[model samples]
Target: MNPVAIRDSYDVAIIGAGPAGLAAATLCAKGGLSTVLFDEQASVGGQIFRAIEETPVTDKRVLGASYWRGMDLTRAFRSSGAQYVPEATVWSLTPEREIGVSLHGGSVLTAARRVVICTGALERPFPIPGWTLPGVMSAGAAQILLKSAGLLPAGRTVLAGCGPLLWLIAWQYLNAGAQLSAILDTTPAGNRARALPHLLPFLFSGYFRDGMKLLRAVKREAPVIADITSLRAIGDDRVTHVEYRRGNGAAQRLAVDNLFLHQGVAPNVNLPMAVGIKHRWSDEQLCWVPVLDAYGNASIDGIAIAGDGAGIAGAEAAEWRGRLAAMAAARALGRSVPDPEETHVRDELARCLRGRPFLDALYRPARIFRQPSGDTVVCRCEETTASQIIDAIALGCPGPNQMKVFLRCGMGPCQGRLCGLTVTELIAEHRGLSPQEVGYYRLRPPVKPITVGELAALPKTDAALYAVTRM
Candidate 1:
């Protein structure tokens, strides 16, 4: 939605209402910039604190303290006087800082002096045999249900993943009295040795005691099967069982009504990439991340990235980063920010990021999981399998974009969100090149799916219509 702010063009337009977006909006507005925050959610909190303002789960223990922290952040955003547009979907962002947004069957173009993307992360695709079955979904989707609707798995369910998010979800389900059949951890046993190099900083970091407590609580209540080497869902029409194998062990099956899969999260890069921001493959996070300066400025002028979209730092770090980025933007606009405020945000951001290397190394999914073979479905949007991608590589498919023309891997409704990483990795493995060499989809705007009827219905300026229709 084109927010009717005090000015037709905002000094800053923050695209998200998660921690980073909220904090950035607050800081920018208080520093005398006309700021606006847009989000697709009905409320202000992003996924990390989804439904913080309207959660049905009243018990704080169910969501934990970190989730509640969004309350204060949202309150500050509201008081900062930034125009908050909920249920607004920003479909396109240009290098010139122009925004094409849609809301409630209407669309408009808004301009901003600067744009900060806080569109966080997407759960890394976990491609396995039978994953496209109806009863299988990502762990992130299940968590959304819990947070937004106070819903829980009604029948036998298994959570298969190796990340702090998976463990946190398991602990929350236990607190909310949901039944769990098992927790399958896919972290290779050897990763502990790899993670040991970063263990000293982790011991002193804030994550140490809290992560241990949550892990122990979930282990006490649920059956945890660790060192999983391989996993797959099994069903005819819907997933009914999960088959997984541990190191040098026979495959075992568990009857399950639902399967929630995850490995880790990567930046939601579609918006950034569509606008021509430079990106590179991150070996640590196992995904593509935008190349950015220290204060969250991207390669593009007047655009910045914060939150997990910058990288896979946690919720608290995203908030601090929001402040830093917003303060930097404010300074660029000739506004004065207190020196102490900048120092405080930087210090806290550093503290939150202290143990991140350890987590990245420890929970790194095994190569077998990342580079699946055989009938495993890598691209769910198009139903493209691992063998299909491999065959494309064998037949002289150069990269992901070329495969899109032939195999239609990233040409679906998601526009490469679900399949981009897996396809890149598959090509990289088969071609004996780095993911960097394989590259990613060359995305352009309309970065999101929009109906022609909706666009035509909008009262558009001549320039707006020409911009969309022109080459």
Candidate 2:
């Protein structure tokens, strides 16, 4: 095998350029390891720290101080001589730690090394009638459109969801010259009271200060309605009106041109599952998170998961986990990790775990999954109806993987990010099994599509090595 023909190998391949990946790459490079950071986006700073080009950082308040911290971190990574590959989507991961990545101009590059998956989470879709309409989109999608692309939905938009992201979207939409009809937050106010005792100690003045800033931003622009029971988007071609059942059981309808809905996020674990990593259910977050230790080591050696890919801890927590994971990987590779620094990292991680009350209280999954409307679209890929999934379950489809074969729910361009959670719930309900038992459908490489020419161009020796590892 010609050495030049083989793709590059790194001491550490960080699979996402988001907060976690960026943090890990920065630390690993600084720690004297050859690091390469890969991201599907054109720039670093995953979803939480979305990248904006040439925009003056004048509106510091809107961007928040944490956002600026992430910016500084990216700068440090760039200066540390880490290879940053943007607009590169990693399609799959082999058990031997080789990553299949689709790059610009349809070229595929393989990076083989100790792997860290920081491939964050996707928004949980709340499917209702007219959800697939033109103007209806996930809350995170709306934020991305506004922040990344500087575009808004067609007209007046109603933001509906249960997370802090809803408030952020409302603030962004209002600032972007888009009219806001209302903000329907489904999170119950009582949740705060219930979780208050656990959160009180962590309620430093800074927490309240940030909350007040967000509250002041959206207070006058939109009405914040709490305890929303149900939502229905009604329109023939685009969103025209939104009907919601209030906490008081009174049905209310608002005339709106667009509707943005979200129900928090779940780990984008397809790549990890494809690599056969273990996972477990998170009852508090209501999703399946990859099984990782305190240092983000998965069951598989040389494979570490950090950030929302391990679980949906926010940016700060992700950064800590990323650093910890990198240190653990370094130690596994026969490098010495400073004992004092490792202890400090573990303590910081503990603090982050302690500060997660607001996130958990604000982002619980909606109870609406208990009774999915028969007509609502459960699988957006093949346009599989909820009824079809129900019937498939009735016909003895065992789980999501089998259901995908039967009904093609998760087999699409978006790869079930839009509909996987709902399908899992429906299958679990029908089979009388827990949602965790249904599990996410297994993901295969190429996680994303690759041209045949790219595959054929792979060095025969490398391909043979990959084949041997598979056996």
Candidate 3:
């Protein structure tokens, strides 16, 4: 798609090309609205389905049938007649529905009648000892490497933490013939008993079958260690060994070089929060999510948030949400569009999410894993330790915003993406408040880091240039 040929204004602009954004853009364009899709990735598939079109993995069995489902969505999006701007980093959004995006060699401001944010979820904060070490990486990051480059960890790789993604990655590693030394399960022992009631609801959800396949595959190949408590990485320069204890037992050490860690995922609320949208704290999910109506409309009138950015329902539900949000947007704009099978879609969405309660309860990370203890580094970009955050709370820092002033915790290049949750939880635990009362980092544009050259090259005096935050 030609960037110069793209219009400065649209009937609707969708920020993100994941399943949610892709579905929304396709439907909105098909409804006779000029729709444009923007994404930082080189392709349409978001993190869950990275490199769908260009993946070198020929055998679909390696990635499973569910992973291949994104191909159909991307195919539909390609032929949906919507303008797609790949590698465009949307930084700022205004109440007037204008988006500030950095693309190609410079930045541009695009206006739309309505904006839909589907920027999706990010991995929950995994702040543990030696997390900032060189070889330490999130399980999602490791999967991205495998998906995009067909690469896997070379040396002995230890998979730790509790999540579906953790087990999925281990299965993928074994499928790809990579070395996996051990699988250290961090799931608390009582998790199964606690999640037992929710298990009945998920029995007919279709995910149970797939979940069993992954579980059996990983268990068959990998050395499994269950009921682990308190894990730590140890090394001089990089992670060389992992230490852990199990239920008041003596600490056991495992030799390792590569460590993959995961807890769970939370909504990526940075963009919506930057736009000054009202967010509510999710007590069950243990994170803050944008306040959205049934149709995915946010607190703002013309803005809608879909996908996991609204919550953590995973990818299938996000696709249904994308379609629902677009249908709502079409109706709001008075565009005559074919009605979706609302009842069927809603039922499928519910079915897709039926397993979440069980999963959330089963995999809730231990407090030490999420908040950590001692001087473990919490903020990778700023090298801010958990102790520094605790000290800030002791000094009555209140929340992440104030703690940012006391210590440069969330002000680094990541701009609080990595450490925001940890800091908020730390302060909340210290002050005896909830994550809601102790709010997250206050974000301002430019949300993504941009080059000075990009700013200098902006066409000044153009009335279309969106007003940036000034001192």
Query: Against the true structure, what is each candidate's TM-score?
Result: 0.96, 0.90, 0.96
lDDT (tens digit, per residue) of candidate 3 on 1-471: 225555779999999998899889989998989999999988879999898898877678787777899999999899989999988999889888878898775788889999999999999888888887878899999998888888879988999999888998898888888888999999888888888989988888888888998899899999999988888889889999999888889999998879989988999888899889999888778889998899899998899998999899889999999998998889888985675677777888889888889888888787777787688999888898888888777877888888878988899999998998888888888999988988889988788988888777655764445565332
All candidates: CA RMSD in angstroms? Answer: 2.2, 3.6, 2.4
Any idea how many clashes model 2 has? 2
Candidate 2 lDDT: 0.77
Candidate with the larger lDDT of 1 and 3: 1
Please identify model 3 stretches exceeding 4 Å from their true place: 1-4, 461-471
* Model 2 clashing residue pairs (backbone): 18-46, 91-447
For model 1, the local distance difference test gives 0.90
| Worst 10-residue lDDT window, candidate 3 | 462-471
lDDT tens readout by residue for model 1, 121-212? 98998888888999999998999999999999989999997989999999999999998999999988999999999999998889999999
Clashes of 1: 0
User: Relative to the unseen true structure, what is the Cα RMSD of model 2?
Assistant: 3.6
Tens-digit lDDT string for candidate 2 (363-444): 5756673247678887776898888888888899999889888988889877777777778878887788888888887777
Measured with C-alpha atoms, the lDDT of residue 352 in candidate 1 is 93
Decoy 3 TM-score against native:
0.96
Question: Highest lDDT, which number?
Answer: 1
